[model samples]
Target: VTITDDSEDDCQYEEVAADDEFSIQEGDEDLPKALQTIQEHAEDAQILASQSVLLSEKSVSEVPEAVDDFLCNFLVRLGMSRTLDCFQTEWYELIQRGVLSAKDTGLVPSVYTRNQELEMENMHLKKDLENYKLAANKAKEALLKMQKERDFHRMHHKRVVQEKSRLICDIKRLKTHYASYEPVLKHLTEKYQTTLRQKMLTNLERDRAVGQITGLQAALQNLESG
Candidate 1:
């Protein structure tokens, strides 16, 4: 049998017979019963397909009840009594624990809102972290500049101190040399004064001797003439 949807889509249904010894042959009394059973199975298949389409179109928040109903029917149909019981127990526990609540489910608007808020906060934190990293780099650069300036000043100060020490040593050496020559300079000055005075006295005594010799010569000439 074939079922066509509102959109004119044709869906074909193929029925498989269950593994049973009941075979309906032509002109058998069970032919009508077999036909009725096939029709019932075809109706059930059509209803199941429609339900599946509805479930697929429904949102997660609207799915729990539909899923529960579908599972109950499916388990009973399949004769999985024990599995059905276990599934019901687990489903009840989840519902009680609020795990299947509408608010906790991703179908709610609040979940999306909360996710947007978290994303905004994460963006802000990342921006702040970048700013902090830039500040740290600037601080490191400033520290390096200060260290270089300090090193330069320290080197300049050391050189100045060394030059000052050298000048002080030179001054002391010059003072010592002057001190050692002071007495010799003083003795030379006194000796020069004494030599000047002795030269003046010797010149005066030579002039007196020359004047006496001239007067005796004049007396001798006058006696010879008389």
Candidate 2:
């Protein structure tokens, strides 16, 4: 069982890894929590940088056929490894003492081998199930984050829409407010045009009067010269 368990040493278990983080958090109450979290992630990132990740692969080991091997496998499958080690010592001693017959260490039945294989398969399935659950949890976290972002954007969009509506209303009010000046502006423009026309007519009349006066002066000079 130990051999089979160590067959693929992909990643080591770090079950007590959070103890260090908890200790740091407890020891440094004055430190900002965000800084502490950043430090933790930095250390984790260093581990990832230093080691090459090995992908986990499923492996099925064939159970040994011997009686002792079967008992060892059984104890290991049942998680009684300490007892199995002690029993192995006793088992060899009894064999050396000749208290056990040859049939005792003979080949085990096919059913026990099949059962052990089934147990191994069941263990693999449990591990796979755990991996699936972990993936589901990460996906759930991502989905929740996305939903929060969606809601945040939706809120911003609503604010923008409200702001846009307010601007539209303000523009409409400004148009109506300024609309009141149109008639006054028209009246002023007409009055300016009328004043300009009157000024132009006075200039033309003044020029004609000056021309008539000059003609009369020229006629008087001609008569006096005659």
Candidate 3:
């Protein structure tokens, strides 16, 4: 009877080991299903990320044209509105609006999607901040360049004024030297004085006639020559 008890105990031990082995194999069978679920989830997440990025990049003016797209379509199908009449402020307000009830599209997986969205938004904000910093730096550099150009122009204007004053002084000295020759040159001048005076008067009258016409025309001609 003692030998019989020992034999029974040995059989029970072997059976327990065999059951453990079976259990391990059965657990392995569930792995494929879990992996497949994960894969499907990852694919959905990728699609959602792509869509979110596209939506974020779209201009305010461009949003209405995509009225039949995912979020809009979903809202419309839910009997929210017929037209995509919501503007910029209304759009953001809607995102912040809490749902009293929502579609039970698998709560666990929907939470995962929401997590992915939050991570995506964080990444987008970081990138946007970087872009804004870069733009601000560029504007500063451009402003500095403009200021330098303005300073250079101011200095050049001062130099031009000084040079103009010197040229005028030289012209005055030359006119003084020519004044002595004016009397001796009268014999040659008298030969055609009457004709020259008549020509000068005619030119003056022509100029006065042109001045009486249109001031705008004269201004336009001055601009074109410059």
Question: Which scores better on TM-score, 2 or 3?
Answer: 2
Best by lDDT: 2
Q: Mind giving the per-residue lDDT tens digits that candidate 1 earns over 1-226?
A: 1111332333445676663323445576786798886787768878988997875455333322334655566577669999999999998889898879744332223454456458768889999999999999999999999999999999999999999999999999999999999999999999989999998898888898888999989999999998
Per-residue CA lDDT of candidate 3, range 36-58, in tens? Answer: 76676668768968986775455
Across 126-198, the per-residue lDDT of candidate 2 in tens digits comes to 9999999999999999999999999999999999999999999999999999999999999999999999999
Please give the TM-score that candidate 1 achieves against the real structure.
0.49
* lDDT, residue 34, model 2: 59
Q: Rate the local accuracy (lDDT) of all candidates.
A: 0.73, 0.81, 0.64
Worst 10 residues of 2 by lDDT: 54-63
Q: Which ten residues in a row have the lowest lDDT in candidate 3?
A: 1-10
- Regions of model 2 farther than 4 Å from truth: 1-64, 76-81, 188-226
lDDT of 3 at 38: 63
TM-score of each candidate?
Answer: 0.49, 0.52, 0.29
The reply for model 3, stretches above 4 Å from the true place, is 1-116, 177-226
Give the better candidate number (1 or 2) by lDDT: 2
